[model samples]
Target: MNNQDFPERTCLICKDKKDKKDLFRLVKTGEDKYAFDEKQKEQSRGYYICKSHECLKRLSKHKKIKVDTDDLIKMLNLLKKGEKDYLNILRAMKNSQTLSFGMNMVLEEIEHTHFLVLAEDISEKNERKLLLRAKELNITYVYCGNKQQLGEIFGKDEVSVIGVKNKQIARGLIN
Candidate 1:
């Protein structure tokens, strides 16, 4: 949606008006209980905070409101978990003889691909083709992280595509 169509929300900490979707939301569900509304679909009195961690910390300290720091930590942990899991999958691939790297190499054996991981920085044309082929073959594909990170896992300066030939490890990465 355009900027005009988006609902504007003022951050309680930063006092800056921003699109509702661009800020974090806290919904008051019970007497003094507040829950972080990531989906912004909660039905209750809600307050907006900037997406910044600093703003979240400030809001958490507000009087009359009880916010668990663990909730914030948990959210961060969940994000970190994805990267960690992907890295672990790459590590396992490094040791296996079935792992394939490079767009050309992956596309060569796309028919038997178990899991396809593509870096976000990959070219649009290549990304679209690989994703489409993966879909046609019913292979699980994940578009995640940056080229540098993916490359680091493969001991390269940058990598755009990786194919896991091991079904068990591929399933683990997809799950």
Candidate 2:
């Protein structure tokens, strides 16, 4: 899809127009009450905010939102927790045997790989090789966590890379 195909919304704090999916939607559940709509499916009055720390912090000062500082902190924490939920997704992929971890295994099944998740601290040599392969295959890739954190998901001592074969899961992870 082209850029025009995506709907846009203005951030209440920054007043910057951004793709709808790129902003966080806060729904007004009741009088002076708001809730984070993670799926953006809430049926009610909604406000959009940029998914950035600066914009989020400035949101508390918006007179229309009527959110307290403490509430803003809670919302920030909720957003963070949502990001960390990717670990659970990874675990599900592992259980379903749709994930390949470690350098050798992933390279062996590179043709079947839909997405690549590399450790933040991956060795420059392996990182460069994996990125080069991913570029050649046109596969989406991201740097997440350290080797130890990623390894814990697969019950390993350490893992520098992971390849996901499920197309749907890969798209979700990259998005």
The candidate that achieves the highest TM-score relative to the unseen native structure = 1
So what's the TM-score on candidate 2?
A: 0.57
Q: What would the per-residue lDDT of candidate 1 be over residues 1-175, giving only the tens digit for each residue?
A: 6755768988867799977755668887677667777776777766876655455566667776666777677544544566677777687669677788888888998877799888867899989899789878988776666788888887889889889888887877766
Question: Candidate 1 — number of clashing residue pairs?
Answer: 0
Instruction: Write the residue-wise lDDT of candidate 2 on 1-175 in tens digits.
Output: 7755868888877898977866788888667666677677878867888766567767766666766566577767865665468666887678888899999999999999999988868999999999899999999886666798789998999999999998888988878
Which candidate should be chosen as best, given lDDT against the real structure? Answer: 2
Clashing pairs in 1: none
RMSD of each: 10.1, 6.8
Model 2, position 6, has a per-residue lDDT of: 64
Candidate 1 regions off by >4 Å?
1-77
Clashes of each: 0, 0
- Cα deviation at 44, candidate 1, in Å, is 6.5
lDDT of 2: 0.81
Stretches off by above 4 angstroms in model 2 are 1-83
Q: Provide TM-scores for the models.
A: 0.58, 0.57
